[model samples]
Target: MTKRSFDQFFKNPRHWREDLVAVGGDFSVDRLLYAYTHGIFPWSEDPIRWYCLDPRAIFDIHRVHFSKTVLRKVRQKKFRISFNEAFPIVMQACSYREKDNTWITPGFIDGYLELHKKGWAHSVEVWNAENVLVGGVYGVAIGKFFAGESMFSFESDAGKIGLFHLFAKLKESNFELFDTQQLNHVTWQLGAYEIPKLSYLDRLERAIKDMVPWVIPLSHD
Candidate 1:
């Protein structure tokens, strides 16, 4: 779809009030980037539903908080932290971790795998001392904006550790936005908050205009 048509489709007033704004589109790299850059995202498959939440949730990068315990665990370095080392594995783990309901279907995985190849998608992986994959967080980055897709953990505090590292990197790299889509318990505890959709769209517009490199080392020492 052309950029003009895609923008026109989302300009409908109905998209402003509703969470599920539009439906039926492929999760192509261009489509995904367009959606995220415009504050919209794909939530489900089987025809593929697109959504833009009314009260969008995001982390104010510098304000993200980690409890003393999590901070200490991070300091202990019991788990290894790495960026983009296990994109597909992390995405698949998030999909199956919630067996009853998962929006990360095969199509979604395929789409993001392609995005990763193009350097627009990334994953922060947490591995135990035994080198076993225990937790991870994955997301898409466009310019200075990052939209966190999902996270999963096999061990206690593992996911939070990965998340902490991601936030650190975003702040270090001077990112402007860290969109979390919606508020869940984990995000709430970590200081994710909501803003009006229009306000989020405004921020997103300016954020994607500037270039901010994702410059973290592939492996954390």
Candidate 2:
């Protein structure tokens, strides 16, 4: 679909708020869930205008590209990948890595924390040999849908490692889709694509229908 057409569909907010409660106030859990299911989400910093974009970017698990460089890094196993071990830390790192204020406001973080407690949000962490939290990614996982939020890295290729490992495991676990929300050059290089907003909503609906419990093991090698 053309970019203009994709941008048009996300313009409506008739049913955005549950009962006319302004969405820009805070990132409530209910609103987060509604936004995800409807192909809209909170992002921008202005609370008064809370941003949601169109032509959403996503990756089909089977389509993720692993380059030779990434493959070599994975094979070397220089860092360890663990799931849910340092969720809050990962989120904080992603937020603060640039040394700037972030879109994942305190409200968003708290809301996601609740989602994690309920098994909806998940985090994949990367640790160096010293077991230091070098990089990671976190997002909401509803059934076959994994809505990637953000990632950060302190060491070279650390973020990529987390991403590749996450995709690899999700594929092994039979995940159907990985939604990156909006694609950038980096994500596009990693095989994410933009789809018609309506198509995205349809896929999201189908995915969330058969909710799969993401079982994260407690130990790692």
Candidate 3:
């Protein structure tokens, strides 16, 4: 495989078959840099395929839909949410235990840890009444854009709660965009839609120009 510059990313051919078929494959720094900067991400395991779909789904902070059911649950105060309190454990749980497959390999973890230390990554964690972690989500923040990675839940509705909390907090703090990468039934139900890949990159470019601090002081109770 040939390496390419960030500017040459869109021109490079995407051959998933060869690019990520090997076990324990690591995305080169340049490749990963290109991926995120271009609104694409590696989301598969085994033969990890790089994905960049047009009409990508994202949640505009002002437009994030919060279901009344979820809001009612949040008001009930049954669970607690915390931010940046348990980064590694939350990420590991999101990968290893809840998801039968994982692309967040050791290398990915270490790389993201470096990102976290650089203040480009963050975590939002949820815990049950017993103060046991039940769900969480993690992602990288580039300027005002947050590229969501993955979330996992160990209890009923925990993941949704975590997402709701994160959404509300981010919106309240005036973030411009929350990139979900890809959308599924749950995300679609909770209000996620797609935009063209090129359009998505344009949005990312604009979003990443704002140096607003991702200042979401999540409540920990």
Error of 3 at 147 (Å): 1.0
The residue-level lDDT of candidate 3 at 180 comes to: 89
In the range 41-91, model 3's lDDT, one tens digit per residue, is 776544546666655788776666767887888899898788888988878
Model 2, C-alpha of 155: deviation from truth (Å) = 0.5
In model 2, the worst 10-residue window by lDDT is 14-23
- Residue pairs in steric clash, candidate 2? none
Give lDDT for model 3. 0.72
TM values, all candidates: 0.93, 0.82, 0.79
Q: All candidates' lDDT scores?
A: 0.87, 0.74, 0.72
Runs with alpha carbons beyond 4 Å of true place in candidate 1: 8-15, 211-213, 217-221
TM-score of 2: 0.82
For candidate 1, give the lDDT of residue 69.
91
Ordering by lDDT: 1, 2, 3
Best by TM-score: 1
Query: Which regions of candidate 2 are displaced past 4 Å?
Result: 1-22, 45-52, 217-221
Quick one: how many clashes does candidate 3 have?
A: 6
Question: Candidate 2 residues 117-171, lDDT tens each?
Answer: 7787889999999999898999888777888999898988788899887887777
